[model samples]
Target: MQSLNEILLQKKIKEIRFKAIASIVCGFLSIIPYLGVLFALASWILFFIVLYDLKIYGGTKNLFKNLFIVAGIGFFGILINVSVLFVILKPRIDIFGGLYFNEDNAFLAIGTFCVLFYITLALIFPFFKAFYYEIARVTKQKYFINAFWAYFIGICTLPLFGLGAIGVLIGYILKLVAWIKFKEFDEQEIVNLEERLAKEQKKVFDLKWIKITMASFIILNLLVLVFIIFQYFISFVGLDYNAELYIRRTLFYIATILALLSVFLFCKKLKTYKLFIYFLIWQGLSVFCDYILFTPPSIIMSKTAYGSLIIVLNLCCIILAFLFFKSLVQITKEKLFYLVFIFFTCNGFVAICYTSLLITLNHLVFEKLFLVGIILFQVAYFISFLIFWLKLKGQKSVKIC
Candidate 1:
């Protein structure tokens, strides 16, 4: 006969395992269309249940409190989304189309809808911050603070784009890690976890190739920024359209090739980094998509096919970023490392958006907006990278036992 405490420990372990499995399943299901929503909702329900159980089973009260906060904010976000969708769709439906509203009433409704939309958008980071912080506490890893900031910035910049997807993906992976760590704690196997973590951190920190790879990544980004600035400057100076187009095309091909090479080099040195491999695959696919886009219409696929492929590639990039950030947090205990990665992720999305708008939108207003947006984003990215670079340069390798 097992003691009461032993029985409770076993039950807690089982619950943790179930949560881990469900998190992974939800991650995969989130990439699916339509069905993804159902799975996401189910995951939230499970999360609440797990948090409640943790509270009841001698787990930290802060975990429950933080998670409840996240749930409340997330629920409000969902409500805002639903309400906005209803407002937009109502005018399209036949029943509602027949309904008439005066100018004042219509303006009021639109203004209210816009306000709600922005409010929901603003809540994205807070929700991620609360969720990640709670997971970090459960895992007992101080480095998850890095993950929390990475995800917060990633989602806040582009809530519906690849950046937000990456944040969510990373959060799911961290959730799985938390479950695993909790299970180990339940089994009393975590006594040496700190020692092991220190060893792993030192080993990773002492790797010269990783330092070199990181430097190359920073240089590549700088080069991309330079080319982007040059490309836009020429346009503003009233250069020939063909000249601008050629420069833009060259920038794209060069950046894509260099980025792919960097990934390959990093993988060659750090084969254990599976997340980097996933990111490599994503960049490769994106390069292929770019190539297809530039190909002649006769040789290229249909518009619908191209659009679908882009969507899928964007989703892949999100998952890759998520995994990459999670892996970085696991290996390097530096909070600044996460911040640097967040800037890189944001820059990537901004570049992609700029390219997309340049190709698809011919309106003068949109072009001006793209130019301004890119400039602002580039400036911010440069500052972040500069700070990160200085920090990296000053960092000394930790000695491993």
Candidate 2:
């Protein structure tokens, strides 16, 4: 049989590798033209995760300490940049009839930003130098040495414009290779805390995300149900069509986000990163269908054809949702999965009912009955959440915080 240390070490290595790839993608995506700032912010979150996993792998509390500070500063810089763009620029410019940014104010902002940038750059370079050295030491990867020099030379030549991009590009490519070359270490390397490693693997669950998503579903669904019934009796003025369409579209948007966050928590515990990614794509496609069903088409198509399309689409949605929950059951090996599954399935049906009944302009009495069904299905949401909480309480290893 394989040794316990061997198993644990492999798991750690796999996790680090997965996180490294995610970080790399986020890092590159941070450079994309319009999306850069958004991804830059996201990249820092992944940066923390990458460093966190590496810290665990190396079994040291103080590993990559300086890099952590650099990450924090980088994140802070993005926020400050955004603040300057929004708060300092546009509002003042509008107040001054677009003349507030006359040369002096622009110069002051640029000068202040430069002073801060150079000071932080001086500190950031050294942190990265130390960070690369430590990675080389721990992983026995000398390519990190080359990575450091490439990155160092790149930043130093940023004043030379495109010349710097060459070095920075090489640096990132080398760093990616270095992560791929990372080796698995023995579990005894955790300062001989193999027993603790076993408990650490018991899994940590974040109930906060769960509760938030559940609350969003309950509140949004109940509101939509109420609005559907209200619109039946009291038509909205200045509204050409049902308001339910706009609100339901909003629900899909919020639910898309909440659902992803909730599923991410599940994936985090299950270590199913790839699975979460697939679900993200599926969710995206589902939302794309939302626009298709809610908005009038640009091209020619019969109403019968469109309605038939929606039925097929929603049916497919229910099936995908079914498989998602079913997979959770299989992976968790928890019978309690079914309750959550039922909650999600009922929510899916509620969505179908509300959208269809609103589109068809059902009688007021029919809408009232649909509202009653919604309130009853909400009970399943509470029951599933209760089961989740009670299950966590049963586990001695889980820290609620």
Best-fitting candidate, scored by lDDT: 2
Backbone clash total for model 1 is: 0
Q: Which residue pairs in model 2 clash with each other? A: none
Q: What is the TM-score of each predicted model, taking all chains together?
A: 0.36, 0.62
Candidate 2 local lDDT, 124-149, one digit each (tens): 77677777787677666788799889
Candidate 2's TM-score: 0.62
CA displacement after TM-score superposition, residue 328 of candidate 2 (Å): 3.2
* lDDT (Cα atoms) of all candidates against the true structure: 0.55, 0.63
Candidate 1 lDDT by residue in tens digits, 241-318: 567556665655455444444444344344343654565555555555555555654465755565455555655665
